[model samples]
Target chain A: MIEHIFPVHPAAIFILGALVIPLLKGRLKQIYLVTLPVVAFVNLLYLPHSVFWVHHIGGFELIFGRVDSMSLPFGYIFIIMAFLGALYAIHLKGSGEHVAAFILVGASLGAVFAGDYISLYLFLAMMTFSSAPLIFYRRRKSATGAGFRYIMFHLFGGSLLLAGIVLHYTFTGHTHFGPLESGGLYFYLVMIGFLVKAAVPPFHAWLSDAYPEGTATGSVFLSAFTTKVGVYVLIRAFAGADILIWLGAIMAVYGVVYAVIENDGRRLLAYHIISQVGYMVAGVGMGTQMAINGAIAHAFCHILYKALLFMGPGAVLYVTGKEKLTELGGLYKTMPITLILFMVGGLSISAVPLFNGFVSKSMIVAAAGLQGEAAVYILLVLASVGTFLHTCLKLPYYTFFARDAGIEAQEPPRNMLMSMGITAFLCLFIGIYPAILYNILPYPVDFVPYTIEKVVEKIALLSFTFLGFWLLKDKIAGQPTISLDTDWFYRKAGTAFMWFCRNPALAFAGWVDMTFARLAGGFLWFCRNPASALATGVDSMFAFVVRIFVGRQRHSPLRALKSVVGWMDRLSLAAEEAAKRRAQREKMAALAQGEVDVRGIDSALFLVALMLALFLLYLAVKYLW
Target chain B: MRYLNNSEKKRIVRYRKHLFYLGLLLLALLEIFIPRDPYFWFDGLPVFYSVFGLLGCILTIIICKTLGRYWLMKSEDYYEE
Candidate 1:
């Protein structure tokens, strides 16, 4: 192991840096924000290639830093992305978003380097909570709702992870964060937790649901971290599970199919995140050294190009306040730089020759071929074709090159363009020199990517896809519509749940309230003049009995009984009237003394008696048992 | 400032379709000369990638559009109402 030259956890730099952001302003804040990532990256370079920062508490170890081949690449790219994201958001005046974003970056790094389950769970939870404000930063109604859903989904996933951790610890008595034994409840629970955050379908709706609702600058950061972190943890823990292979393949094509019909520009890109991460997931499932490297490298290249892709639409949204492709057109005339940079990202993601995606994504596809998984190879290739069709062809055609929509727009801010430019440069650089990326992989790299056969195959595939697009260009244009996905179930279910609460649950509560009120009213009336009421009731009973005995005799012996009953009833009536007058006088006196209603005292006393009875029953049961 | 001037833009617009077709032809020609080591059984066929690309693209479009029209696509406020 390399000796420790830098022992400070990189997450510390970011988390502590976040505290200082609210105190700075103007260019100083920008400089400070940009410097924090740079400092963390430099520190990462010197971090010892071993587990450090281990602490034990309550018979459990919590490791804050675990730097090695497996995690180094992720650590490097995260810091780099933090820099790009910070630069992209440099012009914003608010400090809350900046702070939240910083904390999110720190939490992601914390997760990447965590060597124990406790720290990992903590960082993951922090990442979820911190990243949510970026969605909420949009401050729109849709964004607020989406943010709530986003947190709910992540918290659920986090709970599963926590439960799995607890169970694993109970089973094995260790909290070491490493590969898990398969075919157990904990294994599936942990895998599902990662899958949910990874945006694998059925668990994927939160991404496309919430991402498009983020602020323009915020979405750029949103694109980089959450799912990629999910991918990272999956890589670290569950590399060779067979189920992930088919799930990844399905997820790859799944995103493409949905993206084909999507109309929102950012939402469409969000779907592609699912698609791109699918490639990494499939690679991890392959369990070959080449496949794992490909997964890592693809993740690295994807973060750059994907962020650039988001930056393109984000820039457009920044300038024009529109995110729907149906609402944008002919922007190339005014935003040529944005268009060109966007296409670079577009081409890279499509895996055109000599772009970052070409260099990395091919590794996974080739790994599948080497493993003789013909079906998976074909599925991945087909998904690539779909990727090119929508991201490269459909999106740009509708947003930039189609008939003019007569919307006024111009280039975005300088910092935004600069960030996009730097990201585009990196994508190209990695595409040209795969060695830099290869050298950082967790394992030795020997595969070549620029072989002539591969080049020809990709070129021909993309070229003819263009032909297909030319043929059906009009049919695939963005519509003023939304395509349903798995979120449809939850969104509709949420609505149904609210309806149940509003109608049935609320009606039951109202009925209970009314019954209690009626009971109390009857009891209060009885309490008001109990003596008079009892006397009057007895008099009526006596009169009825006498009448039943001597029915049709006007002046029979029943007349005396009837007179006695009548006199009692009159006496009781007079007594009731006097009691009412006395109560009225007492109420007036109480009012003069600034007191409230005394009638409520009766109900309070009845409630106390009910509680006493319940307590007595509880004591009887406890003692008898 | 625009990346393409008016004349350049008009010129590209006029010849863009021709250029695309030319690109397709050139790619097909390159496939003939490039020595092939097929990874899959079907990849051994002549111009297999071109056919796959074309057919795959068309099929994906047809399948996704059909799904969208019949089931997936809904009104903008499908959730709200």
Candidate 2:
């Protein structure tokens, strides 16, 4: 059992830090930026491993910030990610964005270490919100668009997560995120909300688009913390669920296929991140000892190796100002170290025997196969093929080893390369010796990552796939092309939305806005008229300002008033004639959808005057009428 | 908008060739029902699996010919241009 940790929390520190980063003056600003992350990192470490602290509001209690065995791996890794991300962003010219990046990473650190659901929600939301700056770090058109898309997706996810949480609380009244003891749509919706952020397919566009568009170090932070924490949440809360196995399998294939077809090297790596996450989700979904261990161990290895892969291409961008593989070539001569490190990252992702991916990926594969999920198994195999095709073979082949583009690019700064080199080294170390990771997993280590049959099968499979690449390498070289995905919905369909908004042919909102403003003026004038008593019955008359004028409605109000007035005048003129017609009284019962009174003109005028006075008084208070 | 970019057009032409070879390969793979494997399908096909592929070539060509004329198919730096 992990020991209990700190109880109460100080809310001001996070809020104040967010405030100062934007307000802090020059020269000393970077120092505070760096200080913020270090403070959050060490603060997380100070908490004991097993603790439950509770917060109460309105006689309601929420126990969170409970340190447990599960949060340990993710917590430590997140802190380390923060430290590394801070270091990477320190050299960035845009100090403001760098500060935001650190704050985002700090919040991610807070999120993983939180002991309860509400605390987790607050911190993770901070992580979600703070990531906007990273998306806009480059301040380009693409970056802005990506940032907006990211926010849209997260906001949608947030609403779902909130709904699920509220429903769960209504059902269970407890916030402890342990294994399932309850069943219903509420819990599943909550899990799916987390799944969206985990970059599972259909909700994965923002991750692919935003991560690549950020500053080099921003992507590094992106890789290390955000989605891995999402996977961690799944493992901790829904570790006993069954559907995730299939869901994860789908994610695995979805990611790799899209990655293989991607042209932007950074974006390609982003897609792989999604693919690898699928494996972890499947493992967690398997709801077994070996599978959970596989997901946790794989997540650890993935965080390191994927970061390494991004670093190579990120370094290239830092020095060369290019990210697409089409323009990059023959960097092995200058960036041989990057090439080597990237090769390690690639091999690990491809799960070649004696690499990190093979060890962790194998565990999930074995777990799924043991459960007799043949479809998942086949997809997993095909995914592995796709992973090699893109990440291992394609990424390096196009970036460093393809036809020499004679672009005179060179190795990155020693520090950046050093960060990458470390990740790559660990990938190999873990691959060859899986026990190191297994020993530290949340549960007991029983699964053997390396076995005679396993090694042979993995080698045979990856090697054959590599051979396929070699034979067809000529067909797959030196051209940047777009890969289709859900983004087509947004990129194509979203623009279609803008077109709809702009179109004058249909239900025209712009025209309505214009017409509404004009009609509002008319309504204001009518309210000032002497019709307050008669109009008092129709609340919609006052509420009518909220809506734009319809084609029929435009003329109806004045026409009604005119016809009624006309009736009153005729009534006075025909009074004598009425006396004669009384014997022949044509008492026809009035049948109409709306009420119109001819004789209430004086009362209507008075009512309009009274309404106008009230309106002016309200507008005076509100200031915007 | 006037004509598809040469590079894009080349991608389509390549996909068309791939589709043809892919279809032949699938037919050959299906021929595994034969008693003695003449290996003719395996022997004849170059390097393709099937027409188990979609119309990237068709869509790309159509997009270039039709939508390209009116859609926002401009230079990469369309705003600057």
Candidate 3:
């Protein structure tokens, strides 16, 4: 067991640090922001390799510090990413974005270390809400809408997870978080919840919809955490599930297919996130030791390169204020360093030799081959070809090197470049020496990535893919259009829901309100002159009955009833007059002026009497029955 | 913008295409010499990756573009409208 140097949870470092951000300003805030992640990283290094910090609440264990091989890799990368993301956003003046990002990072770390379902659920929910501001901070109309949709999707996924956790506890009577027993509703519910976060298709549209809409620095942080945490939880609970294999394979191809015609530069990269995550998901599904290592390594490598990828486009958006490829070109002349750094990320994602993706991605693909799953192997490789076609070649070709759009731009801030440079260096370092990453994986590593045959094969494959792109490059250029995905269903449904609320729902509510208003109005009228109103109502009823029997005769029962009602009305009026006269005679002018409105008093008393008699009648009917 | 003059840029662009073709040929040559360690039936086939990569790239573009053109692609304001 590793000796512990710090007993405090790593997540507490960021969560507590976020609170201090509002108090500092200028360079102090920047220094403090950069220090938080570094401090957390140092703290994570010495955490004991066992589940410590266990506490009990209502007879259920809530483990806040579960540091083993599986959680450690994720912890390391998340903090490293937080460091890079903080450095990237160091130039921002506002504190809200910084606070949100820190809390999100903290929450992700919390989820990573959670050893029970309840803590995991809490962290997962915090992750959903905390990350939303990253998108909302863009403050564009599209960003606001996309942020709302993003939250809705995550909330839905969170609810599913919560329900699953509750059901699992009910069934098993424990809240321990680990590999779940399969073949239950909770199992599928939990898998789907994780799948939604992983951006597995059908549940995937939220990622592509919202990610590109985030602020430049915000998207970098957004790209690093949410789905990767989804991958983390899946690694913990649903490894070796057979369905994920095929789903991952299809998802690998599905993303690249959408990316092929994607116009938004950031949206294109977002699609590749889905494609790349497919490899990790497939690795987890394979459930072999090497495969799991591949998934972890890929996740670690992917976060670095993917952040770099997002940073490249983000820098472009930051400087030029454009994100669509249709509106950009020839930036390589002005932003050459950004181009070069971006290429490192693109090449890494393409899994070219001497980049991190090569070291990690091949293991998953090779796992498929070793397992004799031919279809999975082919689909993943095909997706890699598409990844190269779009991310490495097509994206850069158009955005940086194609026909000059004559858009004026410059290199982004110094901190942004520094962040990208550090990430690019790590991508190359991991690719050149896989052993560093391998040594930290949960299981022992047995895979070798740099054999001559594999290198030669990859080079040949990617080169030929380049040749094909050279031949058909014009056909795949970004059009000024958007490609529909599964989000179309919900976006359209959202519109329909709004229409329902505006038209049918509003109409129904108005009708109900009008009905209640009419009833209340009638009751108010009755209260104003109860004696006269009651006499008139009784007269009308008797007149109707008499008309049916005697046909409006002068001496009919209706005439007699009307005369009796008139007498009752007159008697009430006489009483009101007599009370007024008595008050006047007593020289109680104050009572006459304010305290006693004789007619009002009489009507109110009559109304009370009628109600009491009705109540008695109701009581008699109810009790006698 | 000051990094390279127009003439130097033209010269590089002129040579880059040939370099790409040369790189492709060199890669194909390297594959022929590399020792085989076949993991599947298709892996044993010579130049399988090259053919797969090229055809896969073209087919993916064709299918996806067709899907976009016929069904998926929409105006930029599709959701808003």
Candidate 4:
């Protein structure tokens, strides 16, 4: 290869492409589209392994604009992914989204090449805002919901990261992306923000929700770039942070759980993307040289294979317009190449002996083992089995080779097939000869992936898994069920509970006002009393003091106080007098409460009264302050 | 395809099952005799007493199958509402 300094000029070229794309509109858009990515890819291939560049924008020095071995692979993959994604989306018809996708990919690719903290931070934000429209690429009601949720969560992740960036910038004064001498709160806020993109457990709902619903071609763009870019950032910025080990472990297990429960074929694959990255994140957290190598290697493999998985299903969606697992089966009959490509993807992901996932994933697992993380090892292995369940066995069998569910999809378009074929071929290529990937690893490769002992271990495991699938294949009557994930807070319980507490109180007030309109009007006539109004909740301490000092009263104070006191006394005493009336009110409130026991007024009153007093006191303080 | 009596068919099934056990037995023998030096290139050679890898893999697959049966399925209209 020809040597040039900073050979991969990702930004200047791609930005020009993005700017011109919008202008090209409906014209010879294909020319600009093809030229931009091809040139970018060629430029990327020319760069030496790792070179740094610095540019000044106003006052910011932008310390790091370098590319190293670790980044070389990341940038190269994005370039390749962009090329493939562009080709796949060539027929997207509308020109705007195509431009947006290019900007999104280009910005993210540039962001990953960022050497210093400031450049990375700036481009990270750019990458986020750029990709928002892609979430709604299909533009349907479902897409709207999925896309809106996607934007909201990314916004949330962004806020956390911004907080970290602000804190770091404020304290350090030097925006450098390297080992932190001391990182307190800033590190954590930024980490959680990054983790959202990384799709760590509990924060991952936006991914499956947004991705599976994107346009047929939109998903191709979605898979190839950003999230793995997040993992790359995490490795660069916070390697060996200690907590990442457990965080990755949890992500690994959590990903497998959701993947297994998912019935939507595309959603299952989405879940696995996070799970596989979890292995890489955990490896980075291990902090050894070998571990870092493992993480980088795995991330590279993941981007390729994951794209394969998504493309396979997106191709299915392109042909038949269906994605639900139970609604599909035995598609191999019509789409033989698609089936085989999917199978190859599945095998690589399952980390079968001598496949793509086998090499990289085993590296992470072994690194965890050597690091003496017994629990992490066990969970990683369990996650491996789960990967086999959802991806390797479940995905292929259900989609391409199961009991005929009667949907015969034609082969996908040539470009789609070409893209899928390239990714699948890459999967096998990397698997059989991982040394090819290993040599480019930023770190020294002192690790081997395949041996008879290791091979036997992997085989025994896969065989046992084969037996598991054979045994459980009968009970495969699955449906598109929502598993209880961290999203329950926002989706079902949190949102519903807020409404549950709100609507009834509103309606009951409405009903009382409507039913007793005339009588209520009379009460206003008698007592729109200042004390009654002020003490409608709590008389402010300040107001009470002012009333004492000023001695100016707005209402018939004596009458109002006596009437309100009398009503309160009446309200408390009336409960004892009429059993049925008390029971009825309790029942009404119970409907709002979901289940507040009707029979337990005597005991419930003790805690209820105490809590009421505490709440009233809180209101008193709130008003006083 | 060979046509056999019912008893003969049963014997063949038994024989196939027995062969599986025989394969396992040979694998165990090979594990001991095999010095885990590079049967291929040198890196990532299996460190012996990696019994953890072997046993853990078996345990996990069984767990996945069980969970797959128990917890993995739901109705098609699950979140539609």
Candidate 5:
């Protein structure tokens, strides 16, 4: 009887519930949407720490829910964010957005709990397919273009990941999720795949390009899942790989450098997500228990705070339809709650004391210091300062407190404010009481974040950073401009490739085909005119015979034979030409008869009769054979 | 302009000055009292974080601005052309 209660996977709630979402109407739809994540959140708590819902196909075991310390924190934050994301998007009028967000959240949860590479790859692809619609659903030209690019990038990354899994399975003769041994193409392929999603430098431009193009609430949903899942997989597979430490350090600073020049409010925040994920990637690279814990903790905190940050500007965009930082200003006067909430998010991301980022980000920075990597430590610190400069100071200053653009707009809907409030409260709660989050970490909580020296040091760093911003505010004011990133290659190259295919490439292909066709046509003409060649050969042979027999007689019989052969050849050639012309005329007549206009049950009946006759013929052939 | 009174507008105008003085005072207090446990010798210096934060932001802004101006920044429809 106890076993009759099937194990409830958290992902099942969202994955299955998404289908029913379209059936719901109006307020019921909203209620159902909010409840799905709540159910998933509740289910995640009771999920056993061992793999459950195991099914075997052939010799392979498919483990759907692998709940342990490592996955739980990611899963916990994912479902929480899903609930908050749903609430934020509750005012959206369309069901398509809600459906995509559900599938995205569900697929991400499935990925984290996926105990095998097959399940992981499945969920990863699902995540990609579902998330693209969130971007494309906006239906704007830029959004649609960005959505295609986003999916294409992920498809490339997914192919690499799938290739890696196949190689790993072939080499190891099993498909299980665990720490991978270093040595082969599979390892590097898988690592690069994760890095693409993790938004490591050079491959990092997709997040900034696509995230801002999503619908305001859609970006909130998007910010939580895709990159963090990449980080989660990194922790699971490539911990202590050594290369991530450098790649992550580069990603940390690279994202901030881009964010500094960005004029789009959400795009700047998107870049900061790259910067923040870099901390997680670096922590995973450290491969120590404390560092891994730090990565996980930071992933959790970054999701909530990042979503809150997106929500702030999302609310603004929802009301005023402005996304460029240069176009928005003095919104704080009307939207004070959004200002305070956004500040909370900004502070959290900047790692201020009494915010979540401090509690988590400190662990990675401290781990670097303890690991004695001075260069990485310094770079991470610099990135922190940059984070404060752009996200905490520049973005809010320009969008909320800069000289008024004189466009007055009200605060966003209540659900958005409520979601922000919940996220803000969580950020504070985690910062003030780090133990709540620390206790749930994969490693034991041994680090303290609130030492007087640490607090004072953070204060000094942030305070001075604020001073720098204050001094440089005028000089650093946003312009109506877009900053180029690595996506420039694909965006330009993709366009160039399309042009090549349309014009030059097509023309070249046509020329090659025409040349080949001409060469083939010469051979075909010789083959078709065989009667002339035969007649010439026969006439020459007859003349030779007559010369041998008649010995130079004036009227040899060979001449008459040659004339007869020539006449027969001409007749055959004329007949053949006439047949060819007739065939061409027949073809034209058939074409002039136009398409067969079959409609209604007659076509269906004909198809059915053809299938029946073919089946009968197949039976006879099979029996006779 | 829509929501702020005259005093509120004046206070908002003075935000930069207040942030400057407050930031300077905090740095001074940290330099005087904070313990030194540097990961490296440079970090051991008093008010290392302040200098790091200030210098890092400036260098990042300058370098990013330069890069953005010469290479990264483009007209909004750059990709379209």
Candidate 6:
């Protein structure tokens, strides 16, 4: 009986589970949502390390299960985080959020395990669409617009990815997915698309803009999946691409710099997601065996800690209905547990000793040094300093320890705290004994991060960074303001486009319609109703000829008079024919309006003949053209 | 706010600062015995991480502050409004 149990794709469990959510209610829904991810995790363990559940579609293979070193770690963390996220969200009554989030989880896992470009593209596209409602479910006015922009960015990125996929299939005539060379326009297009999802720079604004607007639980789920999926794809496809090294280095620094001035606690953390992912990206870019392994390990650690960080602020928002650092203070006394848990997240992210970040981040930094990329090494180090300055010192100091804001708030619900506790424990565990994480890396375990010298160096750097914060305390204080970013371009441009569509474009279209109508009217008068026109034209010509020839000579005037009469006779025949056509049109309009008798035999036959003539003309033109 | 007396809370805050300062002093003192073998020669200098960490933090503040004053900072409703 056990031998006959077919291998199920891990993602299918959640996807099928998500479909049934709308039917369940209350505790039933909660149990179902929580069980879905657990079942998927179990299914993942049961599946062996080989492609399974392959199907033939057209000429391509659709691989639903491809378990390997690269995909397994991502699968493990994704499922684990989903379970924690579901627990955190267990108190919520909205079934829609659970459904959307579960499908998003399933789709992400599907993308991770997909063995072919077709399946990967399908899952990635699913990931894009299913995750959007997690933002929109907030149902706030700002959420509506932010959600729109978020999807717009993703759709645009999705289009680039789709274009690349189609082009790749056309150029290579292959559908299998694996490491791709950094060659040609299609590959780069695909990379850019991935970069956009990774929230790499100018493409990064959507993360900061939309993430903070999600429902508290939704934000935690979000912080775990989408960007990391992009990183996963990059690791699979574009390892060792030289451009990403520079890009990742820049991203590492860029995120921290922006984070320093950021005041919204959740949004501040959103920027740090970018900063932390920068390490993973830099690691993937370095492309050494240890570096790739480090990249995957860092991604694993980052998912746990970053979700914890987001959940902390999420808890604060849940309790106080406030997310701005400027509006929160002295939260430690009342929400002490939340504060401590949040600090674990903060410390882990800052790469303080005995945290997951310390173990994972050092591998990449060490790789950078070993690879002899001096500039990148320095910038990454600088970014680390900045990460501590913003996330660890500035954010915590202002939110928890600064002057009391006198707002009454307390700890969130039990499930929320438990969710955070799980993540926090993992962060500490991974830090203290990294072999658990290291053993799962794509490469064999070799790195050690806990040497005396390394620990001292970390402590010295962090200690001095804290000293710097103390020295510049006033200057780095949180304020009730926003820091503008690249998103300003689209926000303003969308408004301008709306304005153009409403006013100037409408007016121009109206003008063009009126001009076209007038031109048509003149042509109708000249061609169809020409009898009056011809008579008027003859009179005007006679008067003009008399004015010129009458004064010049008697013979010329007499000849002009005779010529006018002669031309009028020829025109009279044509005018008569035009008048007949005009009368026919009038009769047709009367019959259509029910004013004339279509019951008369002669009138009916005439109409039939005219229709036949017009049909023939149409056929002739069609064939000739 | 709920669990501690006012004086005790004040003491806790003061002690937190004192502990931070003591930790910094320990880091400074420990640098004397730390190994000099570093991947980069520049980072091999005594107290290199500390100096860089301090300078990097200060530089981040100054640069971000300047950016805020002149360009980046705006009313909280900058996007919404």
Q: Which one is best on TM-score?
A: 3
**lDDT (Cα, tens digit) per residue for candidate 4, span A304-416:** 88888888888888888888887888898899998888888888898987679999998888888777787888788778877876787777788887788788578988878
Indicate the residue-level lDDT of B7 in model 3: 97
lDDT by candidate, in order shown:
0.90, 0.70, 0.91, 0.75, 0.88, 0.87
Candidate 1 chain A: minimum summed lDDT over ten consecutive residues — where? Answer: A587-596
lDDT of 6 by residue, A1-625 (tens): 7666676877888888888988988888888877888888877777777888787655577888889988999999999999999999999886889888899999999999998888888898788778889898888989868888998988888889888888888998887888877677889888888898899998999999999999888999999999999999999899998888988999999999888888899898999999888888898899999899888998999999999999988998888888888888888888999989999999999888899999999999989988989899999999999888888888888888898998798789998999899999999999998889988778896878888888898889988988899999988888888888999999999988867865667556555755686699888887886997888789999999999877755468888898789899989998996686556545544454453353595678689889978986876676545
Taking all chains together, each candidate's TM-score versus the true structure is 0.86, 0.70, 0.88, 0.75, 0.84, 0.84
Across all candidates, the chain A TM-score values are 0.85, 0.76, 0.88, 0.77, 0.83, 0.83
Q: Which ten residues in a row have the lowest lDDT in candidate 5 chain A?
A: A589-598
Residue A304 CA displacement from its true place in model 2, Å? 0.3
Superposed model 2: Cα runs more than 4 Å off: A1-47, A180-183, A504-625, B1-81
Model 1: docking quality category: medium
lDDT of 1 by residue, A533-577 (tens): 678778899889987987755668788799889999999999997
lDDT of 3 by residue, A281-317 (tens): 9989998888888999999999999999999999999
Residue pairs in steric clash, candidate 4? A50-A67, A50-A68, A52-A66, A53-A65, A64-A115, A64-A116, A447-B44, A448-B43, A448-B44, A479-B74
Badly placed stretches (over 4 Å) of model 6 are A1-4, A515-625, B1-19, B79-81
Shift in Å, residue B11, candidate 4: 14
**Residue A202 in model 3: lDDT:** 87
| Candidate 5 lDDT, A141-252, residue by residue in tens | 8998899899899999999999999999999998898899998999988988888888888788889999999998899999999999999999999999898999888889
Single out the weakest 10-residue window by summed lDDT for candidate 6 chain A. A589-598
Docking class of 4: incorrect
Model 4 whole-model lDDT (C-alpha atoms): 0.75
| Candidate 2 Cα deviation (angstroms), residue A12 | 9.6
